[model samples]
Target: MSPLVIAGASRGVGLELARLARSGGRPVVALVRPGSDSSELRHLGVEVVAGDALSRADADRLFGSLPAGCDAVSTLSGLAGDGRRADDEGNINLVDAAAASGLTGRFLLITSIGCGEMAPYRSERAIAAFGAAVDAKTRAEEHLRGSGLAWTILRPGGLRTAPATGNGILSADPEMHGFINRADVAQLALRALRDPSTRDQAFAVVDRAEARSVNAIDPHPLLALGA
Candidate 1:
């Protein structure tokens, strides 16, 4: 099997993805930031590469230096402050690097639900803090949609650290709001890497039971909206 390259795999969903991939006997190359703690990944025997994903040259170096023919790529990068430039630039750089790699494999991105026009800000401070990140994710999604690669955009809603229940819901429209466990999200991404039916689809994920119930709530109305 070809190696899987996971950008921002130092922690959270990225780290979980690496662990799962490694346990499944798949080679994993984890991209970490300089000085970022990677003891967890190291403990899992994952190969670690250090670089910032927001820079094209750095991203190129990270991916280029890897062994050829990676089977899949996942970007789990996130933002912490009110810096639109950093978020937008990082996403764009990652997309560009993925496009340049010329690897005919699954390209999966961990984006958030309500990333574009649907992103809700309940307060001015919150809006200011996350506005840039939302725009950046939106742009990144758009780029991936048109990048001509076999892509699957997994947009998760209200990520939590709870245990996984092996169930989740996927909504195509943004009106549905719910929470999802990060572990479940990681599992979904891993599954999509090899699942042919998930290709070329951008889905908003939540707890599966919630999704089914939402689908049952005026199914025709929801279908019409998505249509």
Candidate 2:
């Protein structure tokens, strides 16, 4: 199995993805900003590379050194109150570097709902608070869509810190909206990586039980658990 390179692996879904990869016996490399705590990643035996995804030099250096068959995933997002966001340029750097690295494997990007064609379904409050982030992520998604890499984009709804409920699911429907735990999101992403049918498609992730409004949710065959 080829190693998986995960940017923004210091925490959140990125960290969880690294954990899942390691548990499945896949070698993993985590790119985290310098000075961010990475004790857990190291504990999982993931190679922790200090680099900012926002830096082209850093992205280039990390991806350029990886073997050709390596896969990549970016859960990079912007921080509140910061003018500089890894959500846009940072992810762009990753996509460009991966394309240049001869990465023959999949590149999964974890963007949020309300991006691209799903913009209208987003809540007004969310748009007001995270409008900039959403816009940035939208640009990142566009870049990856045209980057020519085997790509899968997952747009997750409101995130929760609770443990995995094993209820999260993928829906091609743009109207799906709800909350999903980080662990479940990580699990769904890994499943997508292993299933070729999900390539080049963007899915909205949500826990159906928690969904406030959901319809026409056609779960991919590989991801449907009937939960």
Candidate 3:
């Protein structure tokens, strides 16, 4: 099997994705920041690479080390608090790195809900504080859309670390709101990588039960247009 490069595989959804990829017997190059602890990833039989995804040189080194035709690349990089520019720079670098490496088969990006939209003040504030991050993600999505690659952008709702219930709702529009487990989101991300049906589209993920019960119209067509 081809190696899978997982950026930001230190914890949360990125960690779970690395775990799943390793469990499936795929070689994994787990990317983590310099000086970051990666004992967990190391324990999972992954090759750890210390580099910031925001740096072109680091991204180049990481991807260049991989075989020309690797299986997939998934990014779970995000910034908390007010460092949006840093986050965006990092994500954009990763996207550019992936493109430069010619690894375009399956690109999975984990973004958040309420990204790139103007709603109430509360929502706007929430977005503006991390506006740089959201804007970066939106642009990253746009780049991937035009990159002529098979990609899947997963915009998950409020991420929680609760135990997995093995179910969640997937919406293309942010009109519906809810929360989803980080583990569940990881599962969905891996699914998107392997499932061709999810190609070239952006979808929001929530608890599956909630998705089924929601009254919002499907946003698949709209998402397809962006593809």
Candidate 4:
């Protein structure tokens, strides 16, 4: 098996994914921005590279020297505070690098729900609250879609730090929105990577408890809300 490359493995969902991948006996290489708390990732025996997500130079530096036979890649990076947006630029840089390398196997991106055409399904207030970030991520998703790499985009809703919910499920329906534990999201991502059926598909993932059913979410509301 090839070593899995994880960007933003310093903390949160990225860290959990790295831990899970390592525990499964897969070699793990992590890309962390300089000065982030990567002690846990290092303790997990993950090879860490320091680089900025939005910097093409950093992407070149990291991807150029990536370990041989590197095939799988996952990104859980996003922005905080009010910088116009990093989600689109940062993730696009990675996607571009991966596509240009001609060595990537499966690529998974941990994006949020309500991006792209699904934006209108969210309440106007929710969209307004997170619109900029959502728009940025939508562009990132589009970039990946066109990058010509085998890819899967996992859009999990309202992330929570609670213990594993044990009911995470993937839905093809775009109308659904709810919360999912980070652990469960990582589990699903692992599944997606190994499941050849998931290639090139984008799925809405949520805890079954919260999402209930695909039809539970009404996409019609988005028509009035507008993108």
The CA root-mean-square deviation of candidate 4, after full C-alpha superposition on the true structure, stands at 6.8
Error of 3 at 159 (Å): 0.8
For each candidate, the alpha-carbon lDDT, in order, equals: 0.70, 0.88, 0.70, 0.77
Clashes of each: 3, 0, 4, 0
Q: Where is model 1 more than 4 Å wrong at Cα?
A: 80-86, 116-129, 210-227
TM-score of each: 0.83, 0.94, 0.83, 0.89
TM-score-better candidate, 2 vs 3: 2
State in Å the error of residue 118, model 4. Answer: 1.1
The TM-score ranking, best first, is 2, 4, 3, 1
On lDDT, the leading prediction is 2
Residue 129, candidate 2: alpha-carbon lDDT? 88
Candidate 3 residue-pair clash tally? 4
Residue 117's lDDT within candidate 4 is 66
- Candidate 2 lDDT over 96-150, as tens digits, reads 9999888889999999988988898878898998899999999999999999999
Collision pairs in model 3: 168-207, 168-208, 169-207, 169-208
Could you give candidate 4's per-residue lDDT for residues 1-227 as a string of tens digits? Answer: 68888887777778878888889888888888888888898899999998886887887677777654575555544564556356788888888887777755888887888877687687888877887788888898999899988888888888999777667877768788888999888777787777777788888878878884447542211011011
Scanning candidate 1 in windows of ten residues, the lowest lDDT window is: 218-227
